[model samples]
Target: MAADPAIRAIAALDDELRRGMYEFIRDARRPVTRDEAAAAVGISRKLAAFHLDKLVAAGVLHATFQRATGLRRVGRAPKVYEPTGGDIRVSLPPRQYDLLAGILLDAVLAAGADEGARDAAVRTARERGHEIGADHRRRTRPGRLGAERALTIATGLLESHGFAPARDSPRCVRLRNCPFHPLAERAPDTVCAINHAFLDGLLDGLDARSVTARLAPQAGECCVRLTATT
Candidate 1:
């Protein structure tokens, strides 16, 4: 099978020079010539051309030919590069965090009483989380699951969802990655509340009465942690 185009595009940026050129091109706000890209990154024009072609092949950029602006003499329009502006995301186990963001975005646009958009987003997140929880329970048909059993099950689900949950002890589980990153970093109060509510609803649906989701924000990790109420 062929590699995913978006992933390939992102992977192409692993090189420091290519990544720098990508940034310069993206920020230039217009098509950039190989000379300009090379100068910006302090690389040879020949080398820049090679990397730029790689970017174009990976679909991270588009190449166009245009005459130099304010120049009367033109032998040929020089090939210039520009960003494709496509949303590209890659996760190790793959996560649909954007799906959650989109759901919350729809709720916000519906413009319920929460003009601030926080309440509406939080409510939607809780409902969505509950729906997921209920669906998982229905699929598995788990019976009389306790906190330990429920935690084990929830960790598996959370890991696939990109929460990166780690069981620190029998009573506590800490999340190592926030799937709703960048956004969570930008707006912690609203986003973190949504996370807490979502996890709480998940536990409710799972009937995990002894495990509780708590807000214990830490640097470089998820805002919410699960603790055994018992």
Candidate 2:
């Protein structure tokens, strides 16, 4: 059987030396070379290189070749290690605490000046959805979008974002699942408001004059529904 990618990635850091090296590289403002990693972990350069390569293979770190100094040198540029943007977590039945933490952090930051966190989240979510819609328009070049075409584009966007949209009728699309899920259950008002605003902004950005986003929350379904206007 194939090893789970997340498990393999996490197992790479099981070793004390590799874990220490990973922490050092992650905490550093800049990438670290094999030599620096070796010095930090009190290991030989060859051993450090082996462990670092393993980390790279497991997707725990990213490797880039760059000259240490600004000036180009005769020898090959040193290999540097940095933490990968991706994260690895192993959980049975899948819980996403990180996602919750991120949302909470955003809300806290937005509340710094006594502003409403839900309002801030809704604004941010809408802006992001608008950006996605604008990008989709630019890529597909769907000129002078009509109601049908706009619904098609919106459905495609929703599917890409894991919304599982189903066309209930010519005038309505029902989402089969809530991408935000349990978190939405935990904070219905905040999550649903943000979700509604996001879809609203998306339709606006797509210039879908004939369709509107409405909050029609139902059990086991998404909080927002896309409805075609007359």
Candidate 3:
């Protein structure tokens, strides 16, 4: 039941943004200018800049620069902004693993490997890993090397493949990306299989037996540790 630190951080950030956005638009009488928004939210202009930037990035606010009142200046008026058109809409909630977990569960049930899904998932993952390795072999040009020298190459390969692999510790590398955790909610087996496939492919030739994973339910911190085999 412990919260995943990563998930907690993201959730906190999302909440802060949501709160600031709400206050920024509360006046409802006029367009909420970014500076006005900052004052309303009780945050500094610079801090406001970052949050507003996120809002813009999330499509929650649209920006248009126009002239504002300038003090003791004979040049063009300072630029100002306000919420434009209509109230901005949030495209989607923060990315969570709920949906991904469900997908995995469904995949397993559909595959009819409920009881033995874990093993089946591992095999599926292994195959997928092999395919990825083969693809790497095809796409990579020259400078061929053995597995020992290929660690860096493999790491890069996994990154490009969307694994977001990071070295969490000396001997353990953790995976930070997974688009399937939401599916685990509905199809845990499927998610497990998909995760297995991902890690298998990612750590291919790095000693398969050395890998182990821990998936937090609804925490969105699914991690895989690449440990050395005894």
Tell me, by lDDT, which candidate is best: 1
Ranking according to TM-score, highest score first: 2, 1, 3
C-alpha lDDT of all candidate models, in order: 0.86, 0.83, 0.52
- lDDT value for candidate 3? 0.52
lDDT tens digits, residue span 1-230, model 2: 77778899989999999999999999896889999999998999999999999999999999999887677687888899999977787764344455335545666666547567776777767766777788888888888877788898899888756688999998899987777778788989888887888788888888788899999999988899998888
Error of 1 at 51 (Å): 23
Runs of candidate 3 exceeding 4 Å displacement: 1-122, 138-151, 205-218
List residue ranges in candidate 2 displaced over 4 A.
Answer: 1-21, 28-30, 35-51, 54-60, 66-74, 85-128, 160-162, 166-172, 179-183, 228-230
Worst ten in a row by lDDT for model 2: 92-101
- Colliding residue pairs in candidate 1: none
Q: Candidate order by lDDT, highest to lowest?
A: 1, 2, 3
**Which model, 1 or 3, shows the larger TM-score?**
1
TM-score quality measure for candidate 2: 0.59
